[model samples]
Target chain A: MRKSMRITMILLMFLLFLLFLLFLSGCGDKIDLEEAAVPLAAGIDLDENNKLRFYVSNPVFGDKSNDVQQYNIPVTSLRESRSLQDAYTSGALEGRNYQVYVVGRKLLQHEDWFKILDVIFRDARNTVLDRMVAFDGPVEEMFAVKPKEQPPLPAILRGMVDSKSKRGTTVLTTLQDMHRQIYEEGLTPVLSEVDYDSKQKSFRLLGTALLTHKGKYAASLGYQESVLLNLLKKKATKGVNLSFAIPGEPNADVFELDRASFGIRKIKTKIVSSYSDNRFRFRVQMKVSAALTEQLFKYDIQKHADILEAQLTQQMQDQLEKLIRKFQRNRIDPVGFGIYARAYQYQHFKPLEEEWGEVFSHAEVDFDVHVKIISMGTIR
Target chain B: MNQLEKHSLSFLQFVFIIAGIQISIAVLSTPREVSLIAGTDGWITIIIGWLITSIPSFVVFKIMQRSSEGTILDLLRKKLGRWIAILFTLIMAVYLGAMAYIGLLRTLLIIRVWLLQNTSPFVVLLLLFIPTYIVAREGPKLLGRYAEVIFYFLFWLPLVYLLPMKQGRWLNLIPIAKEGWGPILSAVPGVLFAYTGFSVAFFLYPHLTNKQYAGVGILLANTITMATNLLIAIVCFMYFSPNEMVEINQPVITVLKTIQFKFVERIEVIFISLYIGIYSLVWIPCLYYMAYCLNWVRNGSGERKYLIGLLILIGIGTYIFIPTFNQSDWLEHHLTNFGIVVEYILPIAIWICLVINERMRQEGQPG
Candidate 1:
């Protein structure tokens, strides 16, 4: 009896292992890559009839050529848009591989426009690392261009925004970051802006679009100004290069031009704010290790170093003060000064948390800048 | 009848067993529940919860130390009457059996949602039970070894949470005590659920190799659990905004969604799938104790096969009956309250009874 029981146990174990293997190989619905339309990019815009329009782009490989298949549909829900796209395709449309989400300016005008994309963040399988870009015009115009000599539009747009942000010319905003910024009370959302430049006949990067706390489009900052904003926000540490002009003497042989161009390196920004008497006092301090990357006029570096440093500091102070005034004028705090105030001054800032933007608009700010020329571009 | 010396566990193994059971399913949503109550101060409530749960944990150890029988059930039979002992055994069996079943169901549900969305619940539970039965049938010594192995393998899981710190905002943690102590204090009960598995100490103490230092082992286990919960809470607090933190259903796993790699994306999917190992840790001990309680009543020798078959039947029944997620959530909510009564209140009540019985027996004797 014992021998027979041992034999029976071994057979049972073998049969269970076989069942395990069969189940491990999945018996129900499966994700088939070939039958799935791996979307490259998705765009949201408002139709001419004031309805929500969603567009998805997927790449198709052919026998003799490669092309991107585009699907445009007006829908009330984002998940339902996939089914609409499926009517024109041979495969199931999926959002798992989308590299970018393009939002038109018209769509962002609504206060709660961000609520529509809740499915992306809520779905367990959906990926949210895609780049989020805001187009100045209708998103369809940007999608209509099929660069004859380049890769897909999504790859091009992602590459363009990524490289520009790395060079401190613009900001890179992902869907995850945008989600946090939209909800964070101390910070506001800033999306990388893109537009179709009709003059150049191609899509172009247009710095950053600043949004209010409710995610409404407030204003747009230019490329140069975006770099400054990034520096102030500490997003750009080493790659910032600022171009400024120094007034030149017309009579001097070497200083014939009206102004001379120079760049600032190693830019460091500090914001010191204190709340008292229902108002915030901000002391903006900046220190830069500068260099003369280009000079249209000749001046001795060692002889005029002190004068240039002083003049550069003055110019930076003027420009920084102007930028602060513009932020105050628009009543936007893109630099996240409210974040610092709440962290450093908890008791004083807690009561004013909800009205922080309005309080920032009425606050008094002063600029104190220090610039030191460390090198003259590999020259004396 | 088993020998007492043959089933003893070392001190570290005791600690690992308690810590493993405490951490399994609670860590998945502990941060979110705490944040919903206390906001950014949720970590503080976790510390408070750990200290409060330690009282019952010590009471369990003290009661076990006073017993000379092989197990808690045997002691109950020796001190109390046979009827009372049988009553307590049934209560414990039902409690532990429910715990094991709910834990397995939740694990399978998460796997279905996060990792294997296409797989059937029955198939998933079948594969999950294989490892659990294999490890648990060998008893506490091998269970200890399994817990230790899973711990060492998954110790790096917390380190993965630190990757989200790149997007963290230190400002979100500020304005400390902004919501005041009321919210933080109220959140302690929610945090206590994370520390609920400590009641396993009642069953585990009689098997300890060094009973003298069981106190230190219990405290060490609680400390490990508290530190894990605190780490995840603080990371989630800093990574997500206050409003956003409350919105997240599972802050620990959702925070992992931000982690990306060039070679492999969606690391959380892989993490949740591998988390099946740790999930089995909780069910193994619970199922073993449940069967052990039944054997106490029946005086049986082959509890292993019966326990494994019972667990499979329960898993299949729950899968068929509780076919939807909302029903599972509703059942889990009720079970969590039941878990509090068994894990929190039962130990202290038993300790009180043991004290009263000892005093009454001393009075009855000629002193």
Candidate 2:
């Protein structure tokens, strides 16, 4: 009986220790739910008063009785502070900081907006990397314009941005992808610009906003050019349609590129150096796959497979060359030419850093594209 | 020998204990330091160091096999004089004791960082040591058996990390041997530390039913451990650049944190919990070694109560002395280097002296 009592006492002690450990496990105090607001998206714009205007979207829980409601707050001068640090010193409104934000689409042309991005990344409380977009006009107008029928504005925007057709070219830019482009020497940050239509009360994707090497506004690629950019970057998904022309046809032939199975087997870049004038010549060799979508010529094109292949290869090669020339003319090294040069010719690239723009502009480019038309769809 | 009473562990269990000891906190962080010294050729040094240690590990097992019923303490005393044997035994005891203490502290620190942030250090240490002491007091056979059970937990941890394998870059291990052989040669000391726990087999040698299989068991253990460590090191290098790894104190735990499961919120928390079993696998053996050494010191007639008291005191003393997480880190770094010397060099030196003593005895000469 005494021994059993000792055993019971020891067991009780062990139980107490376990309970104590459980008690000490949770660290911080519970946050008041009512005081906190979960911001799905936010927008920052410089209003006419020349003060920073912050617009936040607070998501409201939907029940059977209540339709989904979103609260929008347009606060001019987010706290009466002058400096950026002082501006946020008043603490987040309702214990929520800006989770996602949009800058005025015009601000993408200013190049100085990247400095604002650096500040956002440095903040600790902001955890959500939901979505970010650049608006064509004031960011406030874009946030104020709501969709007519949707589960929620955030969900609708998320669906549009996450859609494969829009993701790479016309959707929100992820922080990780943006950071990667910003740090890479030749690669430029391609952000999606949004324009608000007051009549439709909706947001329209205005294609890709390109940030220059110096973090300035370089140029914007329209919808067609943005799709071409996505294909070039290999970010294009399956079911993407690419239209090219047959040799003598006025109308273009469309092909649905199955990017999932597509392979860039090799990209051989050669830089032929001319020591006399310090001029560099570039030669690029690309291997890609093309799936035929439409047969422009009605005649038995199956027998003329080689002819069709040649025409398609020549057309793709011409288009790629034109795109490369456009990039060079804009003084933008979108192909990571500088990275390639550093990897191959370190000595030449060291002195060419200051004159990279001029060198890139004057460098002659030769394209050797090997487009293997694997299967001409089910038809032919 | 009755079939039912035959005291032997399966080959897998033996491998688990061996690999468990080898893949400690050292395997997680030592690769970065090794990289600093060996540059891109650190993995090569690790392979070479494993080979260097494998030779001694085999020889130690061979020596144990030659003695049917005696432990290393008995063989050492027979080969050398009593005083020298006792001296070596004391050194090994101290080394093993320090290893257990540091392992416990580091395990707690990892738990504190990854799981229990609010728990006091004393509470963490107490919770960890209580279970460790209970297992230690149970003796070597139970420790080995416990290791067999916990090995499954240890096995699944790497798979948790494999979730993020798509992000790993094979190019990170590229430009191999670009920094030359100078750093590779310098990294040998740290590389050998990962293989230190194979020496624990010496203390548990007499407990094995088939002593001759000891060498094979240890060799298999060493090979498995070296392979696991190599994979971990390569994966860590591929996941993060050398500069990024250098900034992290607990690279392995941090690497686990980077892994996100679709259903699970934080994989590191699961890793830290599973890692408790791994720590027990190492701690039990070390504590058993200390207790075994204490038994030898008492001429194998020590009271059970006295030994338990000594074990508790040692646990408490080490816990108190090595206060704070930083000191524990320092203790681990310095003791690992110290362990290589005492656990490796001292044993080989004593073995040489033992062989000489046997030769002299066979010649009928008393020096």
Candidate 3:
């Protein structure tokens, strides 16, 4: 009797396992990739009526027409917007292949606009590594313009930001990166910026947008300035080509070369912060190993390399000092000077955590730049 | 079944059983809870909590050494009356049952959120019990083997956490102890919840083959628990900024979302699914002890019958009342508080009583 009971129990368990698998196969939201609307990119902006405008671009494959289908809706939350888009699309909308999330300047201006993104960070299904791009105008306008030669807006936008970041012209920001920066007390957030050029009827890669922890837009950096920001933030190392006119010479203007260009072979930045006399002082020293990539004027390479290096060093020092003053004037630390202070001088920085921006503006800063032209090209 | 000593556990088995029981569902949320209180100073708090929990564990080991009884129930039956022994056994059976139930519920909750969103919790709970019953019914010796095998199988989990460190910021841990020692000390009680499974030493000591090394084994178990919690907390602390850490429900698991391979996406889903193996370590032992407690109440009779009965009871109990996430959290909150009394306080009290009684009885015998 006991042996038969044991046998019956084993059979019952085995049968139950089979039934569980079948039930699971039939239960829940069963979706096939072929019928699903996989969004490649999402654009969010504030419409003219002050409503939230969400744009989703889904790339169609194997059909050859309607190559990229777009959806536009005005919703209050990301979750609602996604569900509403799913209704209009042919199949359920999914973001597993999502590559980009763009926000417009008007929406970023609102201090609480980041509150709408709670669903993105909270949902386990959403991707956190997707590129986060901030645009100068309506995101819809950028999404409306299809890529002329590239596959679609998602790949084109991603490539634009990535290439610029490689050359140190912009900072590549992702959802996780922004989340960290916004939450960290010692650092502020910055996103790669793009602008829609109506005349050119194309999208251009703007430099970067500096934002507060609350996601409010504070200031912007141009392409040349973003290189300096990236270097100081330690986000980029090589491939930054610096082009500036020689000081005191309006334009040597040799041939068609506009300015001298130096391709950075190596670069290093060191920051030392100390507290003294009821104030904080910071010293920023930069060392650069550069190759003379392009020269506007005919100069002797062997005889004038030292003179060129000295001149570039002085010019870079002045530029860096001016940039520091600009950040001070704006009362922002996009270069993460506050992080250095808090890291190296915690005793003095712990009390002033909330007022770090104001304290940073009042602090004294010094700059030193050293440049060595390691290679002057094959010609010179 | 022929000779009880044949079912005894080696020192290594004893250590893994303690380590396995200590490292279940609690490790997932420990980073979040510690971060909420102590911020980045959580790693330090984990070590301190480890040292504090070792105190009760040491006392329990001492009690086991002083008594040569086959189990704590036998010790209690000799010192106290049979009724008192049975009463304590019932209490322990209820406590272990509740703990196993909570662990099983939390595992199903995580699976639902991450992997099987559409599967009913009842079905998932039942499915979890199959492997659990298979391993647990063989007694502690086989349970020890299962723990050993699972340990080797899942040893790579901690290394997987290092993948997310590429994007982590070391600066998040700076200004250490910024809130002073007040927060770290206060968070110690919270950290002790993660170390509660060490109480299993009280029951496992009689089954130890080499009792001389049991002390070292339990200490090693505590050290493993400490290291696991410390590694997990520090990883989450460095991966997410202080403010973001607070916002996340389980930074340890959520941080895994960023790790993607060329062929696979959503690795956390795969991890949460495979984590069923580790989660079983909790319920299997707890269920085994609950069954043991029931058999002790019957003076060590009908062990298998009692094990099957308690398993069915747990299944029916879970099915009748499935806890929502909030309710499950509420249960864990109460369990942590109740567990401290049972896991730490009750053992120490029993140790003190045993010591005094032994001293008084010795004095009378000498006279």
Top candidate on lDDT is 3
Identify the CAPRI category of the predicted complex in candidate 3: acceptable
Q: Is candidate 2 or candidate 3 better by DockQ?
A: 3
Over B41-102, each residue of candidate 1 has an lDDT whose tens digit, in order, gives 88889988888988888887888887654778777788777888889888888887877776
Model 2 per-residue lDDT at A27 = 48
Chain B TM-score per candidate, please: 0.95, 0.90, 0.96
| Model 3 residue A328 lDDT score | 81
| Cα lDDT of model 1 by residue, A1-380, tens digit | 99769956975895688587666767555648789777799999997787999988888866724488887789998878877888888887766767889999998887778889998987788887899999999887777776666778899889989899987778888888888888777677899999987877777899999888888888898877887788788888675677666755454665545444456667778888887787888887888777667655567878988887787787777777888788888778888888888777767777877767677899888888898988787655
TM-scores, one per candidate: 0.92, 0.77, 0.93
Candidate 3 deviant stretches above 4 angstroms: A1-5, A8-14, A17-26, A95-97, A197-202, A248-260, A263-266, A277-279, A295-307, A344-352, A373-379, B67-69, B79-84
Q: Distance (Å) between predicted and true CA of B52, model 3?
A: 1.4
Q: Please name the candidate that would achieve the greatest DockQ relative to the true structure.
A: 1
- The sequence of per-residue lDDT tens digits that candidate 2 reaches over residues A274-380 is 22356556666655566666664453556876776676667767877887777777777655565445434546765675446556777777777766666676663
**What order do you get sorting by DockQ, best first?**
1, 3, 2
Residue B69, model 1: Cα distance from true site in angstroms: 5.5
User: Candidate 3 vs. truth: CA RMSD?
Assistant: 2.8
